[model samples]
Target: MQATSRNFKDNAHRALEDANLQKAMGFVRTGFIDKRKAAADALPEFEALRDAARDIKNHTLANLDRYLERYEAKATETGAQVHWCTTAEDARETILEICRSVGARTATKGKSMIAEEIGLNDFLERNGITPIETDLGEYIIQLRKEPPSHIIAPAVHVTQDQVEADFRSHHKALPADRSLAEPQQLVAEAREMLRQKYLDADVGITGANFLVAETGTSVIVTNEGNGDLTQILPKIHIVIASIEKVIPTLEDLGVILRVLARSATGQEMSAYTTLSTGPKRPDDPDGPEQYHVVILDNGRSAMLGTEYQEMLRCIRCGACMNHCPVYHAVGGHAYGWVYVGPMGAVLTPSLIGVDQAGHLPNASTFCGRCESVCPMRIPLPKMMRHWREREFERHLNPPAWRWGLKAWAFLARRPRLYQALTGLQVRLMGLAGRRRGRFASLPLAGGWTEHRDFPAPQGRTFQQLWAERKRAA
Candidate 1:
């Protein structure tokens, strides 16, 4: 809702105080984690599957160009139009042109982070075309006139009461006497409302989970069957996805699939895993008449040979965010991107520019839960450290922090000074503990003392303890 993600602290403060948001966060913590654990426990080879999945992604990315060309050729052979656009505007313009040719006025859309990356809805709406979100979570946020907060669960910041209130306000045609109760009832109301929109829609757009290069198929997975409706019911279907989603084969897809659901919602697989290869054939009973695959390369090519290339392996499973304590407390909107949590911290800076989003990489406890749970095994904290390095190299860091880092670095490089500093700090903390057990307010630690007390240093510094042991021996 804000113009930029720069006001994270202020926004996080707001999120922390929201009781409704806390309830929503509670569901995410228990519900998502428990579901995934159950799914993982059901499979004896879950860890092995994760390893295989990571290998497939790594292999695919290494030969990305080759696979992409093969995919384009295969897709063309199948009668699907493959459009490659290097920029978001280029991709949007190409899609809009295709829609215009078909006289499409209304479009139904499935959940797509790539679409969010390009701001496609606003672009379509500005041109007087209505773009309707079809996914339940996405639909909720859209009706509430808000941007998605979470990647997997877009409306994770909203409570059930808030959703009911939104549905009542937006679904004005529904009688006031009609009860706005139960998840199922609310779902039925939305299902009925969107069913008409789907039937009447001129164009349907969806994002690909994995683009099978070998078969020229765009794979879309959903818990709801909306992707099927979104693709089939409309006369035309558009699949817009990033180039990085491409995998070599269906066998490779299976490996990733095993880990994807378990890491995200802990399902063996989502309810629907639809693979559409081109448009409807003459023998086909029902499908889109026209199929278009738009491959987006919005700054992704730059990450190809770079240290951040591992990030391309992300399957959008959202495991990292779900396990994040900071995200649980402050919520996804604080990160201010379509992708949030640890992944967002690394990605937002790259996509939005480090100068504008440098603070994101620092918004971490660096607990490494993200890396531990990541199915693709992307070292998120390591990537984030690279962002921090870039920020320092570019001199984009705040002047105060820049000086503080310089001072710390100077001391750290010199062991004598570092040891002396640590000893002094330990002595002062020990003295403070003797008086009050722990420090409520500590000088030179304005950041930590703000919300929490600093634990007293254990009797002595590590260096002091080690030196005394050596002397005794």
Candidate 2:
């Protein structure tokens, strides 16, 4: 769970050369994009749903304190414990205490990014408690001792062959000759191996997609049903979520859920959308004995009333990264953190610091595709630009970039001088590259040209062409 965000350039370079990663990244394009398009097209009210979802979240955030208080009162009424954590340390320690109170030797876990954000697994392991990941993708990455590359698809960076190898290596008791050539076979193996873990687990921990205030309910949406098992079978159920996850009402949650699955996986609805209010009632046959909700702030509260508040609307559908060209080229590991792609680029800076994650904001190409496809209508590219401005303001950017931007700004302030300088530079470059029409390598721009050639100017600048058109008219 240690961040390597500072080495993003190195990580991205390595990812670019990794054939396995490239092959796996292909799924990001064909799988999520087409399915989301089809699902959205099928639902005529999809756009309206997105707008409704955004407004619901905004309202909840505007009165977050009132909603959280109401949620806590209702949850407590149902005999659930609600713990508020202002920091990661507080959240981790709170979870450890809960595990200790239950005398938990091993805990079953559903895929929770809040857990990753707090380094919960390692903390639990260090404290002599075994944390078992039941979600298939989480289980795969847990076995490999790697952080999730994608939010929903943790093992997206891992290939089928790698998964098969990991299963063989971990499941030593199984037959060596067992066929794992197909994905279903691999799933069966993982399920069989994890089934015992679920039965033996003393406690179960999960993350909430939305914490409803009206009913004091924690909602988890999934396709595998692992989350349901993780939260229900164990004696104690612990729900870990960020503070912003709270919504005003069940009706508000319904609107968000309508778009969440479609935006994430192209499904009209997830196979399982489990809601747990608290512990089992006397009449209930199957449920946990106790329930606890740990809401962690972890720098999210600092985003309020700022330009970055729009980011809070994100439902983690991952539509931005699915369409991102940079994410496709480098994969999620290059972001060097839990969140990845466009959402990661903006959120990482806020959660971690802009100093450590400055490169993430700069990684985008300003394509704006992320904003267009986002279910919450988050302006991802705009937020990234905001991060860049913050980076520049804090003097965190490299000296060369600082000077380059300064130089550009100086010329840009004077229209005539900017035009004259660009015109001269363009003519010189045009003459030089007239033969080939592109430069394979250019001074001070090797980063751009290293992978491909940079197209040369076609003789005149846009201003000159516009002037000519005006004269002709």
The best candidate by lDDT is 2
RMSD of 1: 2.0
Candidate 2 lDDT by residue in tens digits, 1-473:
68889899999989988999999998886898999999999999999999999899888889988999999999999889999999989999999999999799999999999999999999999999999999999999999999999999999999999999999999999999989999999999888999989989999999999899999999999999999999889999999999889998888988999999999999999999988898999899989999999989899989999999989988888889998999999989999999999999999999899999999999999999999999999989999999999999999988988999999999999999999999999999999999999999999898788878999998899999999999999
lDDT of 1 by residue, 46-148 (tens): 8898889888988889999999999999999999999999998999999899889888999999999899889899899998789999999999999887888
State each model's CA lDDT, in order. Answer: 0.89, 0.93
Q: Residue 127: error of model 2 in Å?
A: 0.7
Candidate 2 error regions (>4 Å): 465-473
Cα RMSD to the true fold for all candidates: 2.0, 1.5
Which portions of model 1 miss their true places by more than 4 Å? 1-3, 434-436, 462-473
**TM-score attained by model 1:** 0.95
lDDT value for model 2: 0.93
How big is the positional error of residue 299 in model 1, measured in Å on the Cα after superposition? 0.4
